[model samples]
Target: MNLIKTAFCLIILICSSIPVWSQTTGKIVDTDRQPVEGATVVMQLPDSTYLGAAISAADGTFSLEPMADRYLLIVQHLFYQSQVVKGQTRDAGIIVLEPKEHSLAEVVVEGERPLVTVEQGKLSYDISAISKKHIVNNAYEAICKLPGVQDRSGKLSLIGAKDVTVILNGKASTLTQEQLIEMLKNTSASQVQTAEVMYNTPPEYHVRGAAINIVTAKAADNTLQSELSATYSNQYFGSYSGNVNFLLTKGKSSLNVSYNPGYSHIMTVMDLASMHQYDGQVYDITQRQKINTKGWKHNIYAEYGYQINEDNALSVGYNGALSGNGKGTIDVNGNFQNSHNDKVQDSWLHNVFARYSSGFGLDLGVDYTDYSMNDYNHLESELTGHTRQLLDYTSDQKIRKVSVYADQSHSLANDWTLKYGVRYDYTDNRNSQLFNQTEGKDNVDNSSSRLYEQIANLYAGFDKEFANGLYLSLSATGEYYSIGNYHKWSLYPQASLSYSPSEKHTFMLGVSSEKEYPTYWDMQTSTTYMNAYEEIQTIEGLRPANVYSVNANYLFLQKYMLSLFYERIDDYFTMEMYQAKDRLALVYRTQNWNYYQSFGMSANIPFSIGNWLSSQVNATVVNDRNRCDHFWDIPFDRNKWACMLSMQNHFSVGSQLGFDLDAMYRSSMISGISDTKPVFMVNVGAQWNFLKDKASLSLNCSDLFDTMRMKVKNRYAGQHIDLNMGQYSRTVSVKLVYRFGGSITKEKREVDSSRFGH
Candidate 1:
């Protein structure tokens, strides 16, 4: 009976699209015969639904996908006119889009609703500090409050996407967890404009999933602005920092200069543990370790752009940061194994890039990073009753690469276009660790090392549009793989289609393949560090993981909108136990040998209440399956489920005063790290204009509920401290901003000498 049912289902699928092949198929191009990148060609059906569509590629070329129903073809681009090829299925051939200058809108909303940027039916968010309200003294402490967002240490899960990538501007910012936070700590919210959070990237973006693009103020306004800021925060200790930014622009040429001076103090407490059996009673022992740390982070950036004759332009950009770290530790008991660990780390990076634009544009640049860390460990173990100190060594290294890429766009014909480009980056690194605490004659070197291929992604794509309101696009990306001693290559493919039958209805389907490497922290060997117990314990890194993603969605309703979407993944990466095996003292040894799979659904609904409030509700559910060959020692199960529900309310009372509120609730990881239950979180912020736009007051209460807490349990026992782990915190901030340079021709930007938090 099961085989019969399966056979019937297969027969139904084979017949579902049999009639679609009878439709006409052709390529779309512009007057120059160039393919327009992301240009959408759509075909409208009788039911007011877009049944088929395509996008143009680098060469201003596009392909038409056959549909099963009759429809009207439509084509459109960023600065182009909407071309409608109104007709029956017989007319579903070539879609030619014309270029139309569309820069007249005074205010461009960067949200994924398509108010700004090209809309190929994918969601996008721009992560910028320009317009974002900076909550004094915190970054992730603020970021976690974002809707459908959560951060555990350095890992950020956006809309429940564990394999997400956080990008600044348009490229990657490879800063460590703490460094990344420190960098954000100095950036003021006033410098941000909009952040586009995109779940599915179009063919043009050669990056990872769920991108947050922070867009700063651009030259479109022709205004010059600058500001300086400083901040002080008290948690474990009082910390202070400073930042300065100078921007200048006139017509199409712009120049920017900035420097950030970060001086800070930190103190943290940790707990450790071990287990023992006495008199048939199993007990866990504990230990405590304390560290008082001091550090400094310095950064510099200079960038300039010239319009050099309309058709040709150029830009030169450079940025770099240097940091110094030092720490001191103290032991309380005679057991030195539970004593303070002393250490220091110094790191710096610099990069330069020059971009040229002409008939075909080119991007040329290079970047270098230098990093090093050294530590001193003191051991006081009862087993040996020996007190000794050992000096450990970590030889961190780095190298930069010269990269060159080009983007070419040409006008193909009426509504058809094509576009393409490629980028290359070279990298080199050398890192190792050593300990000299034992006898000089025999010291163990537990660190494994290697040096090999460092390169940028080689990618390309093609797109096409149909005047019938139908569009289709194809993209191929070459991925980069680097590990301790292994290097491999993979091809990522992407295909998408958008169809709209009427002005207010749209549908989309897409599929793709991609890969992600474990961060240094995830792949690092057991890092020799003194825990609260003062013992030299190792925190091994999780190995690199791979993924395959698929998604489908639809949008409609002239005024009321409702859409549904789903995404599935394979071989997801996370941490799990191996063989459920262990010994006393946990002489720990584990590999990055964990795997899982997951699926999720998302829905968005928007409603208006009278003329005062604009509100929207979004809900999502994700289920993950842990498929490790053996769950063994792992305490958590292979199945996890998490759901998130959010509500966004925008208030409008005249124009001087406005507010935005977002609230969220989430369930445990369906296919996540461990077993965590549900929790509630909220974020509220408001912006008020005073003195007729001369001054503004922004108030924000992030983590309003302060319910953001994460907890983990340790399995072993130590001498002095117990391993009790979790992180919970909250922040409250308010800012008063006033504008100075107006009617007067803008001069070189002047950094605001003093501000509470930059």
Candidate 2:
């Protein structure tokens, strides 16, 4: 009886001694009333040894369990100013944040590729921090060195994938893959803001194999600045390049302009050696050759911006480029045969864009692009002696688009919030082509078509975090798309869940569905290319493919991360062409009779041997198969897998000195007669900066270890026939730059990728 009395007395005493504490529950919402999920909330500690932190949910609600005492709370997110609340002693009070103004300037994400990995299916790369080091001569080379990316033709292969589309500010580019590569090759890296590698694209990106958004710099703030750069390279011959930029700002108005010009005289002599075996017998062959190509290009761009009000702004931009025709001749002396070929291509671009935005989370934009090109080809064989024929072709193309979008959010409960958004897009395109034969023959006109494409999207999502160190989110989306022969309405459902058992340990998994539409070339019968033999046909006009995919992504902490994806396509379209004529055909057609399933896995792992340096290896492997009418393997199917492995060295000298190096080993491949042959290739580079980081220099060497190889095999004729080619594949490049640009905002900010529709 006495012991019980003593226990009761002790409990009463402790309760009386404790101070009163208040618990609050509230939600965080943006100006548009949309919930701000994943925003970090921090409670400052008066004592030096402790800190408390929590993250918000998708619905925008958060809770504060009574603190020992209430202190200032700090809230922050990317593209938003930090928000603080005082006298908030352990009580839930609703908090709101204003969106920060943004410049189109590309954003630079930071982190050494060797030391970073996706821990929760979240993948990222920093462009801003990457340009600070002289890793390559220009942005062109720098992108080629991106982690998980392969350089088959330097521009065609991005992240080990092909048929990727590059965009500027979420808009389709006026330049083709080949032209884009040329422009960046002669441009400086200093102009780059950031490059994002969006591997697991959301639902909207299903139409593309990959997307690379190039974010350039916006006009300077209120300060005025200018920058200039020059580059010269001595390899196989020589080349020169120069660039100038100007910026001005007054109050809410800012303007920026850039001019770039380049000239090159590339002449090379090459001797290729190879050996072939047939029935235990060996034959040695050699190709002796010479080539010279020279040309010049100019790029110009100007942009003006005005802040209509605190929550509204207007901007306009114009871009144009003039380029000289490239002249090149290839001479080959192989075995007992001699050959020569002349090539020329003409190109130009004209583009204009405008946009308006309101602080209410509304955006309206319009864009126009005009593009034209011409090509001429001539060839001569010693056995025949004179020129046989000349092929001429020209194309004029135009594209225009307009878009309207709005978004909003609301708070539900403590650690919970809701988000919603809608978007409408309209695009129109037209293209025409002309073809001429050698002797003033009747010219042929390729087909031309004009059509408008419309797309709409809507989504609602919820997010919340738990006091037990757990977070969860659920979202649903509906999208509609319609185009020429391709039309589809799909309901894409996506969900994400995560758990943080502790600070150093976390786990996440997500699932989503997507639909891909046929490209213009795939959907039109006229866009395909054909050779001398009509038997070799390239078909066009394909249908949309519906894909249901489940993603399993995990990051085993800071040292390792991995993502596994499996997808089943309900209706996949593939282009099959007959091979009977020229090495490269210009006309092709398409058919849709095949369905396929593909499974892939990609990973990034980091390891360190002491403090000397750090390294990372990343690779992707996918297996997919379908049917084709051109080649006779089997009506059943043929399966192929592709893989890539890479090694990187960060900070060659030391940490503070800043340096980067990357080398890759991709698997050898064989795909009918058109697939490219694989060979070991390596690139090495170094750079330095002086004069208060205003002046920089960089040098790079490509294909220094081995020759770039491509062998296209022929499946016809009794003779073992194929075209094996090589040239002066090694190249050296250099770059120098000086900048005094408008006041670039130097703030730590974060971006919510989920802000875009699922």
Candidate 3:
């Protein structure tokens, strides 16, 4: 309690000590009298000395703090001519910009404009610059083209950052990563205006660590738009997916809806060899397994927004996903074990949310999510000495979550801003496991458990922009967590500082602290079987991990970046295969480690050749160390150094055809007691635009050399295991997209369901 009070007091004192300054405000409009959003407004001295800058809001309004009584105001936009005005008072009034004339003839441009810039202590990338040189069909593709951004197997992360949260229009979202990615796939690339990346997030966003905010273009009133797309992919099996997105705006109301449906057939194989030492005896085990899964999934989203007035607005939305008729089969054959299993599974998730915002910087919102999953499995196994065993079981799990939040922001004197918020979350989870048949002395039993968890959070922050191109932000959060008979309180503090001396150089530094909790099912006392020789079990009395991170970044010429980072996690938990001391079984269980530490450095460089080829190269080197003194009966310490390199190239042939090639390589790494071999992968894609740029066709091939396979070896304290894992990593896919009607823009919403399932 004393620490929390001291932190808050420090922030208040710092904010109150800054001297007040006069402000400059203005509005921008195009020749058609339409509000010009996303225009750059700069306040500068007569000799071009920079003072400050602001981006025009949705209503074309802007505000900036200027130190001088007389200054020069400049407004610039991409499709318009620049405007300059001499200002002496606080108000600059409305300014109009004329449209730039364009040639109708076909011509090829030989040079590219700068696409990256530093604004308001964040890295901003112009989507228009990318769209002019690359063929991007959706927002997700455009985001992938940004520097230092990486996409691995449908998951997105920023280079040198631990975790990334994605939001839309600078608003907080409750969606999980998977759901947010799906929604971005359905959004049209033309609707994206810009994307901002923040290393140290603000308190008003209600998210910690790094974040990516995607800003979309606003639609004109009384406009309707729609887009339809279909995709087909083939790996070892075949898959099909299709989606439709629609948007409508009239007067003061807007409606957006999207639907996506997919069917997939997936197959995977694994080979394992183990040498076990138990009871002063040595035993050798070898096994090969194959699995096949087929399923149909559907995703739906709908949102409605109403403008009650210029000062107040209301919005509501629903998001859901359902899986139907999912079936799978597993077959295993080994020297000491042979098993065959059949399984059925089904799952669904639904989320609903409503929010209200006022011009006074007050926001109120509520969200609810419900999720359920059911699984049934039957297995028959033959062990050593011709012993046979049979097992059948059914499992069901359900989760319900509710959250509410209120946020307020105040524009203080000078260029300072203060924001505060409070939020509460409640979750209920229920899980049951039933056994129908068991034979040959089963090692697992039927069980049921129910868990209730609650979290309350309070946060406050202050931000200031100095006249000399320096920016600073400080924030602190107090949290109270409760589960069953356990209760705890924690404090998290974050700080960030940035300085830009000129257009050619920018520097940033950030420090943050946060906590991550274990999943619901991982904390329960449950057991599951994979084969006769292997089983999965859960432990009780698990604690959440605390993470502390520091990051520093430098950007040069808006095209190159160098970053350094260090992270430490206490009580880190992970799943590891342990040799049972009392039996001949290999158990996979989640256990907490003493600590995990990592330090890394990364660099990104982008270049172009002859206006036809653009390429980006990224490289990272990291050292990881792990220590645990009381792990089962054997204690060990491990450390390793790893390196990663990736390159992306885009080639354009005329105005309609484009080609892309991307490749990545990772050196060997160690986790727990396992050491993994190196991995390399390459992907190629081609796109063609037709029908006056309204339709596009693309072809892509991933894992061109089929080298993305994992080979792991675990050899420690007289326990040895060799595992080779492979999946349908190589795939060939084709996609077709068509757009019609007027221009469209839509917002995205997410639910808090990342830990809802097993």
Candidate 4:
């Protein structure tokens, strides 16, 4: 309690010392008086010093704070010529610009948007600008439209890097990567302003590897508001699900809550032909298997925020999920087995954050999470022609985690920034399994593990713009990590250089290094039997993987982007399946491989047809190579080529309706010993708004051709397995949303406790 009070007092002191500035407002429009949304408005002092910048809202209106009574204002938009207005006051009134094509160069095409831009080592995509040309339903879909983002086997990745993290509103969350992806899929992207991608994490971010930070727009024009939304989905395997969300905002306080309860039914079928060398003879085994599963899931989340002042704020959040028992039936080689399982998880977070205009920022946060899961399996089989057999298995697991961190940042002259932070994280996990044979003995296995970690990081760097439109950023992080009885310290370095040779082109080059840590469960020395023919295992003493990469990028007219990159990973973990005991069963395990390398190139282009239809396309090609071996002592080496092509289209029908079409295709790829087949998917959606634009209804159909399935072939010495997996890809969904508000308002952003929970 004393610590809390002390921290609160510190933040209050910082906030109280901040100097207040006078506010300003203005609007921008084209020569024809059409609103120029997404225009950059900047205020400059007499000495040409930057006061601040803001983006023109959808209505071409903007607000800023300036320290001087009279200043110079600059308005810039890609579609329009730059405008400079001097002697501007608090209310600058209306500023107009001529179309860019009217100038000598004719650089910018009408109705085209500069969707992607790189500044000071960060790549940012203006979501609102892109959404004008492409159809984006949710935040996840919006991210998928970025330059290098791809969905591979139902998982999101950036430029072939699978180890990526997400940050919301400059704060980390306590959800797993998969959970975060789900949440983003359900979240509407209309609330977001920009999506920033970082290939090499900076020291101030306090995270490793590639990351995507979602920056949300602060509401403008304060007014009480509420939004209610609901969605219904019909998935594959004859299952249906529904969800609802409600949000309320008034003044500086806002509340958001959601609930989702759904059921899942799925069936998997596989045909296998295996050959094993036993007793100087090769035996051929052929079998057909079918598995069916059904289960129910419930998830809930609530978050509330209040602004204590202009610079300080507090927030609290909760997330919980529960899954009911799932019944499974399997038919393998004329043998039958049955099983069931259930799980529950809960987490909470609280944060105290403060920001000062004097270039000092502080964040103090704490988070706690608890997870419990239990599964009971009963198997009945009759295949040997002797007698009916029965077996029982029970597994139980529990995990608890607590994390606290304090971070501070200070700004210096000449665009230099200094940051330092410390974090304490603790975790405890317990797992137990019991196996019994009806006619034989009983086997019991138990494992308990605990980890206490502390990390302290310091980052210092300078971002400077020199002559000839050249900008450079150099930053390095010194981090010390202590876990259990081991202690290590390392320095990560990052650098980037970019130059705009002309209005038509910008070039960039960067290099950085990052580390990838293993998940808590991935390092446990435990074994789990999934069924009569499959088992799961993990190796102990797993170490963090290290990555080093470099990239070069070129931007043509800000509407088209091209990039090339190379990445190398050491101590990489690969998942492999092997034949156990003469092809009787399969064992799945994760083991560290020698190394993995990839070289890739990507391109993103946006275009418009007339004024009612627009589209964006993205493509990538890569050469992937890996040196690894199967668990059954078989050497494996592979060098494969991969490619992905995606296109999104948006069409406007009159003034109250809109339609969208999206498609993506990927060539074959390799993961460990498994070679996956090619896959493609197409989706279409339509939205209608009514009730004075306060209510919206949207209908969507996914996987129109039903090709979003995973087909893989695993091969090793004297063993082969062909497998197929299906998910909820082929589905139809409808969403209804209603809002009651006078005007949208902005809320203060606070650094939360998400970074620690993970």
Write down the TM-score of every candidate. 0.68, 0.67, 0.86, 0.79
Residue 40 deviation, candidate 2, in Å?
A: 18
Give the alpha carbon lDDT tens digit for every residue of 1-758 in model 4. Answer: 37435733654453344332234777787776655667888889878999777777644666665568879888998778898888656778888988876334766445545567766657789987665555565678788777778766557788746467777765654455556666676566665678988776655566656788888765432222334566667764666555455444444665555556666676666655555455666645555666677777666665667766768777776666666565666666633232222222233323333322222488776666667666666665553434454556665656666666667776677656566666665656555555554432234355545555555666666667766778877777777776567688878888878898786888888788776666666666766655445668776776667787888888898778888988888878766777766445577887787778899999888788777888888899999888765345776778899999998888987656889898999999987777888999998988886775556788988887778878778765666777665644577878776654311223223222222221
- Tell me how far the alpha carbon of residue 494 in candidate 1 is from the true structure, in angstroms, after superposition: 0.7
lDDT of 2 by residue, 213-288 (tens): 5555443233444667788876668889887665555557766566677787776665544333345544454556
Q: Which ten residues in a row have the lowest lDDT in candidate 3?
A: 14-23
Name the regions of candidate 4 deviating beyond 4 angstroms: 1-112, 237-273, 276-300, 322-359, 386-391, 436-448, 451-458, 481-487, 581-583, 629-632, 727-729, 742-758
Off by over 4 Å in 3: 1-76, 79-112, 131-136
Tens digits of per-residue lDDT for model 1, 406-428: 55545567654565666564444
What order do candidates take by lDDT, descending? Answer: 3, 4, 2, 1
Give Cα-based local distance difference scores for all models. Answer: 0.50, 0.54, 0.81, 0.66
Model 2 TM-score relative to the real fold = 0.67
> How far out, in Å, is residue 155 in model 4?
1.4
Candidate achieving higher lDDT, 1 or 3? 3
Best by lDDT: 3
lDDT of 1 at 455: 45
